[model samples]
Target: MPNRIEYYNFVNGGYFWHHASGETYPLGILVDQGDVLSDRQPHGKPAGTLIIYKDGNVAVKELLSIKSEKNVWFAISGCTILPKINMTAAGFTGVYSDIGRTTLRPVIGYRKKDKKIIIAVRPSSSITRAQITLKNLGCDFGITLDAGGSTALQVKGKKLHNTTRRLNNVITW
Candidate 1:
């Protein structure tokens, strides 16, 4: 998590939360000011979502589709929580996987209705439940960042969730 001085540097600060996790470096492709910080190759298929910040706007895109680096002020990746799937009247049953065991999740969500980006921390939940929560929150798409002991969230300088593990990436505003 960022300290007081570091958090103050953000132009439009509102929410501050841990974004990604690693020991010595970030796990995904981290971009700052159009500079590629870490291009760590993914192990299997691109299952991450790229959270991008550009022109004072935030966009969440699939890791595989983001090919261009133009105007990318800052970028980070997180595990895909809500994959592209047809939402029928029943529910998102097809995407309910038991892979992600119950745990705290830091999420980034995108509402297609207004093209708004949301940064929130979900309570101890599975990936399926987290996806459902975001879907209920009107998020069309979302991703889960490093969770468990690395999960952290702060709103308006007040610590909501703080972890002992060191954080590698954080998103402000």
Candidate 2:
């Protein structure tokens, strides 16, 4: 069956996740009651502590509690991912949930489940449209995190890959 949530092994590549409390719903921007971030916008990751799984192990890396990049961490699950060819949406960043600011949150991170890495991020230009597309593709549900410049995928604990400026939200592959 097709589902929006996925699991992974951090071996091939890690994935990202977006969470928000019971905010932005029906419109359903936030998934379940958990931490969330706008990857498309470079504002930040989840507001709470985020655990990073590395190299297909149970070890978790806690993202430092800071206001800068040091606090930023990646999403690693019991899944593996193959190198993905980024389509677009790069060099963008944004503040958390502030529409007045000119920024972007990119979907950086992957989950390896069912032989695929599910990336998470905010919709680049049009969130509504992006959600529509994902729903059409069987996403059904998704959380809107930071997009634009903030959207970045990190692999191997401290390495970043994939960045562009085409579709700020949603995983291309």
Candidate 3:
């Protein structure tokens, strides 16, 4: 916890620490989320995007519609705290984690509290359940993006080491 910033009481069924500039940042709770736009079978590539609004909100999303061209998929989540990464990248681009085959994979994305980074995990099959868990754990809002190895969390222009590939779409800041 050298670069410790803040703390999230409940994340991925456990508490998580955030680091920034070799020091952890102050943490906050996840506040809001919605799967209204998350399309799994997107006909288009689902980039799995995480957005932090200027108003202080963070969200994970699907870039394209696996279902059809007209229908796009995206999972939006808002939280009491969504930190922004000072540097790096975001998006699941390839097969790094045991996805589709594994049970619960890692959830890589962003936090808004001290603008630090955050990563969470959920089951492989359903992103909804993960959302529910995040909700219960102070992260009242959060959406499931394309999990598995395709999950990536970025900062600035560089991608983090724990980044995942095999994604369909990706939204940037």
Candidate 4:
């Protein structure tokens, strides 16, 4: 039985040796089956990292707050688009800007009633709009994935949005 889904993008920005050819390395951590494939700590606090375990458990935690565990399978790190605290409390203000700006938005959230993870790609919306949409959809907690031109969402070999720019990382279920 599969407990959760996994997605991969390029990498989070961080300390790295720049290539003369203009190729940049991923600075964040990527763990597979308890084996670390890439492990470069991010330079600053990002939104957070989504951790998925072998038992079908999922969590969105603060940057650098999580320690490696035996049952942990993998994780995705990105700038904290939305924090868990705001999701639970519903007090969204000053945490985000560009409310009027619209772009492709990718989001991950947990629906407590359904006890399932919700993955969505909003065709065009701002962070504020995304928050309102997620709240209305009954998400108890959520976080924004990479958005703007880097946004990409695919299901069953079908592309949800046509993104020309190559993404550094992605999350899938």
Candidate 5:
């Protein structure tokens, strides 16, 4: 869980946060170091995956399109949070219904132009507002890892935000 970030034994200090709100037992796809950790569902339904390659490139792809490539370092699945149909805020809520609700959320994004990854937590924001935030931050694509009580963020062993709800998975450096 994201709250346990401080307990990890990492060589270089980095950030940690909640990754996904999916079921813990396994339903969608999850991969680590080229190993398929879970794939009960085989395909991610209404979900997007954050792929981190061993070479350090990142991409947000649909779950159905993912493969356990040799160079893939890790992959985390979650709901798409930005780039709605036609790139309009009005259509953003159509992708995920829960995102329409205003609440705290943890997000991960990528800026294709500059090859930057954006990770953040937004408080009391709707999907539309969160999309706007991501766009303002220069993100071309993004996904909402978790929301509400599951939202969390930590950096350098210190928590910038903490959640009361226990998390099933988390992303870290």
Candidate 6:
């Protein structure tokens, strides 16, 4: 599949950030051929990061040791709200305690057996609930993506959900 970053200014009917800056930004990092297009430093340590290699391989890094190298094709960062490392759900109860505050939520997970990335955009869910869902989906590792109004997912040419806000960046398969 071809991977490229596409910019959008409006979603669901509102501008991203509620400002008309006319400049599009990625909600997460965008790396192409090891070139870092954009990397949003996590507020603290990222909840998790999904790394896509140039050789068409994918991995979910749960620790804080992420680095940019020549083989990394893409990297998107998100608060590790629910880390299912080692097949155990290690939940986070810090600044992202709004796990019950449901809205549009996006999550990235790794199915160890298939060695594939599982991207899901939930209509309404909290981090805790999302973690459980990921676990049930057999994700050995998972991380919550930038959600709320920024939550969005598109398959083929059809949008899974609609948001009024535009996004700075997007990760595509």
Count of clashes, each model: 0, 60, 59, 10, 0, 14
Per residue, candidate 1 scores C-alpha lDDT tens digits across 1-173 of 43333562122211123445533456566776777766552432344555556666666564533455468876666566665422221122345332266887777778878878777677777767778878888987776666666677777777777766555667777
Q: Which prediction has the highest lDDT against the true structure?
A: 5
Query: What are the root-mean-square deviations of the candidates from the true structure over C-alphas?
Result: 7.1, 15.6, 14.5, 7.3, 6.3, 6.3
**Residue 32 deviation, candidate 4, in Å?**
3.5
Off by over 4 Å in 6: 1-28, 44-47, 62-70, 81-100
Candidate 1 backbone overlaps, count = 0
- Residue range 119-147, candidate 6, lDDT tens digits: 77777787677788788888877667666
* Per-residue alpha-carbon lDDT of candidate 5 for residues 1-173, written as tens digits (9 for 90 to 100): 44254543111111123446533444445777878766532232435667789899887766543454458877766556667522222122455455457897677789998888778777888767777888889898876665666666667767677766545556666
Worst 10 residues of 1 by lDDT: 8-17
The best-first sequence of candidates by TM-score reads 5, 1, 6, 4, 3, 2
TM-score for each model: 0.70, 0.27, 0.30, 0.67, 0.71, 0.68
| Reference-based TM-score, model 3 | 0.30
Q: lDDT tens digits, residues 102-159, model 4?
A: 8877777777787787777786787677777678778866766656766656577655
**Which prediction has more favorable TM-score, 1 or 5?**
5
* Per-residue lDDT over 21-125 for candidate 3, one digit per residue giving the tens place of the 0 to 100 score: 333211111212322333332122343344444444545443333232222222332121112211112222244222223345444444344554445554553
Which candidate leads in TM-score? 5
The CA lDDT at 64 in model 1 is 35
Instruction: Report every candidate's CA lDDT.
Output: 0.59, 0.28, 0.34, 0.55, 0.61, 0.57
Off by over 4 Å in 2: 1-117, 120-124, 154-173
